[model samples]
Target: MKKLAVIAATGLSAGPAFAATGPFFSLRNTDFIVLVSFLAFVGVLLYFKVPSRIGALLDSRAAGIRRDLDEAKRLREEAQEIYASYERRQREVAGQADQIVANAKREAEAQAAKAKADLKSSIERRLKAAEDQIASAEADAVRAVRDRAVQAAIAAASSLLAQQVGAGQRSAGIDEAIDDVARRLN
Candidate 1:
C-alpha cells in the first residue's frame, strides 16, 4: 500500500496534462512502458522478500563453511598428535632393541670366555696326566734295571764260590764240621 501511494504521488507530480496527452499503452510511448515494467519488477521483488532470503541463505552457507573449517583443523591436530605418539613409541622400541642386542653380545662374550677357560683347563689336565704316566714308566724301568743287577751279582758270587771250593777242600771242611758237631754233643 505504501508503494502504491508512492507511485500515485509520482504520477500526480508528473501532472494531469502529461497523462492526458500520451497514449498509455502505445509502442511510441516507450518511457511510460519502461517505467511501469520497472515498478512491477520492484514490487514482485519486495512481495517475495527475495533479497532478505538470499542474505539468509548466504549466512547459513557461511556458517556451515566455518564449521567445516573448524572440524578440519581439529582433525589435523589429532592426526599430528597421533603421528607424534607413534614416533615416540618407535624411538622407544628402537632403544629397547638396541639394549637387547647389547645384552646378547655381552652374554655371547661371557660364554666364549667360559668356553676358552674350560678348554685351557682340559688341556692342562691332559698334559698333567701324560707327565704322570711318563714318570711312572721311568720308575718302572729303574726298578727293572736294579732287579737285573741284583740277579747278576748273585750269579757271579755263586760261580766264584764254586770255583774257590775244591772237592778235597770240601771234604776237609766236612770233617771239621763233623768234629765240631761231636764236640757239641760231648
Candidate 2:
C-alpha cells in the first residue's frame, strides 16, 4: 500500500510539470501554483479531522431515528390493547341487556297466566250463582202450584157436600171435612 501511494504521488507531480509551459517550480508557472493551493486545502481539512466528525454526526442521527421508530411501535400496541378492552366491555353490556329482556318477557307471561286463571274463577262463581237462583225460582213455582190445587179441592168438596146433605148434617159434615183436610195437609 505504501509503494502504491508513493507511485501515485510521483505521477501527480510529474504529470503537471510536464504539462507546464515554463519552469515547473517557479512562481510564473500557474500549474505549480494550483497544485500548491490544492495541497494546502487538503492539509487543512486533514488537520481538523472533518471526515471523522461528519461520520459521527451521521451515526447519531441514525440512532435517534431508530428510537423514534421504537416509540411509535409501543404507542400503536397500547392503542390496540385499549380498543380490545372496549370491545370486550361492549359485548358484556349487550349480554346483560339480553338477559334483562328475557327476564321481562318471563314476567309478562306469568302475569298473563295469572289473569287467565282469575277470569276463569270469576266466570265459574257467576255460573254457580245463576244456577242457585234458578233452583230457588223453581221451588217457589212448585209451592204456588200446590197451594192452588189445595184451594180448588176444598171448593169442590164444599159444593158436593151442599148438594148431597140436608142443612144440620151438612154443617156437621163440613166441620168433619175441614178437620180431615187440616190433618192431611199437616
Candidate 3:
C-alpha cells in the first residue's frame, strides 16, 4: 500500500511536466513507452522473488562479516594473553637473574672473608716464627758473650796467681783452684 501511494505520487508529480510533446498515454509517445518498460521490469523483479533473494544474500554477507569480526576479536584476545604470558616469563627471568647476582655477591663476600682470615693467619704464623728465631739468636749471642767473659776471667786470674805466688804454693793453689772450678762448672 505504501508502494502504491509512492508510485501514484510520483506519476502525478512528473506526468504533465515531462510529457510535453503529446498526450502522455498515447502509444506513440516515447515517455509512455519508457514508463511502461520500466514498470514491466519492476513487475518481473517482484514476480521472481529477486528482492527476497537479494535480502537473503545481504543477510548472509552480513553474517559472514560478523563472524570475521568475532574471529578477529578472539584472535586479539589470544594475542593479549600470549603477550601477558611472555611478560610474566620475562619478569620471572629477571627475578632469577637478580637472585643469581645476589647469590654470587654473597659467595664472593664469603670467599673474600675467608681469604682475609687466611692471610691474617699466615702473617701471624710468620711473625711468631720470626720472633722465635730472634729469641734463639739472642740466647746464642748471650751464651757466647758469657763464655768469652768466663774465659777472659780465668786467663787473668791464672796470670795474676802465677806472678804473685811461689812455685810450690802456686802449683798447690792451682790444683785446688782447678778442682773448685770443675765442681762449680758442673
Candidate 4:
C-alpha cells in the first residue's frame, strides 16, 4: 500500500503532459467556434425551454390570482346575503312590535270602555237610591200633612158641634169618640 501511494504521488508530481497535436493558431481558431457553439447552445435552450418554464410559472400565479378573486366574490355575496337576511329579520321584528303596540292600544281602549261603563252603572245605581229616598221622604211628608189636616178638621167640627149641643152632652160624646178612635188604632 505504501509503495502504491509513493508511485501515485510521483506520477501526480510530474507536470501536466497532455497537449493537443495541432498548431497553436489552429487551436486559437477553434476557440472562436467553441465560444460560438456554447452561445448557440445557451440561446437554443432559452428559446426552446425557458419560455415554457416561465409560462408555467406565470400560469400558476394567474390561477392563484383567479382563485383569490373568485373567493373574494363568493365571500362578498355571502356577506350581502347575510345582511339582507338580517334586514328582513329586523323588518319582521319591527312589524311584530307594531302589532304588539296596536294590541296594547286596543286592550287599553277596551279597558277604558269597561271602566266607563262601570262608572255609568254605579252612577245610575246611586241616582236610583237617591230617588227612592226622596220619594219615601215625599210620601211620608204627604201622609204627615194629611194626618195633621184631618186632626184640624175633626177639631173644627167638634168645636162647631159643641156650640150647637149642650155642654154636658158634647163632653160625653167627645170622650166616647176619642175612646172609639183609640180602640180602632190598637
Candidate 5:
C-alpha cells in the first residue's frame, strides 16, 4: 500500500512536466504508460475471474439481507399475533371478573335478606313466648284470688253458724249427724 501511494504521488508530480514537453499524440508519454498499466491491471483481474467473484459476493450479501428482512417480518407478525391473543385473554378475564363480582353481590344480597328474615322470625317467636307467659301468670293470679275468696266465705259462714247455734242445739245437731252417718254405713 505504501508503494502504491508513492507511485501515485510520483505520477501526479511528473504529470505537468510531461504535458509541457510532449506532443498531444505521442506513444512515449507517461499518460500512455499509466493508461496501459490500468488496462493491464483490468486484464489481470478478468483473467483470474475476479469480476465474477465480486459479483457472486455481492449477490450472496443481498440474499443474506433479504433472508434477514423476511425473518424480521415473520417475527413481527408473530409478535402481533401474540399481543392480540393476550389482549383477548385479558378481555375474557375482565368479563369473568365482572361476572364474579356480580355473583358475589347477588349472594351478599341474598344473605342479607335471609339474615333479616331470621332476625324477624326470632324476635316474633320471643314476643309470642313472652305474651304466653304473661297470660299464664294472669290466669294463675286470678285462680289464687278466687281460691282465697272461697276460703274466706266458707270460714265466715262456719263462724256465723257456730255463733248462732246454742249449746243444746249444737249437741242435738251432733246427735242427728251421728245417726245419719250410722244409717249410711249400714
Candidate 6:
C-alpha cells in the first residue's frame, strides 16, 4: 500500500494537468497513460493468478523444506535411541560376563577344595594300606624265623640223641635227652 501510494503521488505530481509542464516533457499525458496502463496490466496479472502461481510454488518449496526438517529430526531421534539401546545392551552384557566370571571363580574354588579333600583322603588311605602291608610283612618274618628256629632245634636234638646213644646205651641216653629237652624248654 505504501509503494502504491508512492507511485500514485509521483504520477500525480509529474502530470502537466495537475501543474506546469516542463520543457523536457512533451507527452506527459501519454507517459501518464502508459504508466497507468502498465500498472493496471501488472495489477490485473497479479490479481488474476500469476503471482499466486509463483506464491504456490514458493509455499510448496517451504513445505518441502519443513518436511525435510521434520524427517531429519525424526531420524536423529531414532539414531539417538538406537545408540542408547546399544549402550544399555553393552552394559548388560558386561554385567552378565562379570557374573559368569564370578560364578566360574566360585566353581573353581569349590572344585579345588573338593580335589584337595579327595587327595588328602586318598593319601590317608594309601598310608593306612602301607601300614597294614608292613605289619603283615613283619608278622610273616617273625613266623618264618620262629619256624626256622624250631627246625634247627629239632635237628640239634636229633644229632645229640644220635651221638649220646651208642649201640647199647639207648635207654640211659634217652633219659639224658629228656632231661636236656626239659631244661631247654624252661
Give me the overall lDDT of model 6. Answer: 0.85
Error of 1 at 12 (Å): 30
Q: Comparing candidate 5 with candidate 6, which one achieves the higher TM-score?
A: 6
Return the top candidate by TM-score: 6
Task: Report the Cα RMSD per candidate.
Answer: 13.4, 8.2, 6.2, 14.3, 10.0, 8.2
* Location of the lowest summed lDDT over 10 successive residues in candidate 6: 20-29
Each model's total of backbone clashes = 0, 0, 0, 0, 0, 0
Q: Which ten residues in a row have the lowest lDDT in candidate 4?
A: 15-24
Lowest-lDDT window of 10 residues in candidate 2? 13-22
- Give the C-alpha miss distance for residue 129 in model 6, angstroms: 0.9
Q: Candidate 4's C-alpha lDDT?
A: 0.84
Candidate 4 residue lDDT tens string, 1-186? 999999998887662332434453453556556767898998997978987888999999999999999999999999999999999999999999999999999999999999999999999999999999999999999999978876786687688768877978998878776676556544
- Candidate 6 per-residue lDDT, tens place, 59-165, comes to 99999999999999999999999999999999999999999999999999999999999999999999999999999999999999977886688678767777867
lDDT of 2 by residue, 1-186 (tens): 999999998898788567778788888898778889999998888899877788889889889899989999999999999999999999999999999999999999999999999999999999999999999999999889988888888888999998999898999999998789878987
Model 1, 1-186: lDDT tens per residue? Answer: 999999998988797436555676665676677778999999999899998999999999999999999999999999999999999999999999999999999999999999999999999999999999999999999889976775675556445545777866765655665566456544
* Candidate 4: regions farther than 4 A off: 1-82, 179-186
Error of 2 at 180 (Å): 2.1
Better of 2 and 6 by lDDT: 2
- For each candidate, give its TM-score against the true structure: 0.50, 0.51, 0.56, 0.49, 0.57, 0.61
- What is the overall TM-score of model 3 with all chains considered together? 0.56
Clashing pairs in 1: none
Give the lDDT of residue 184 in candidate 4.
57
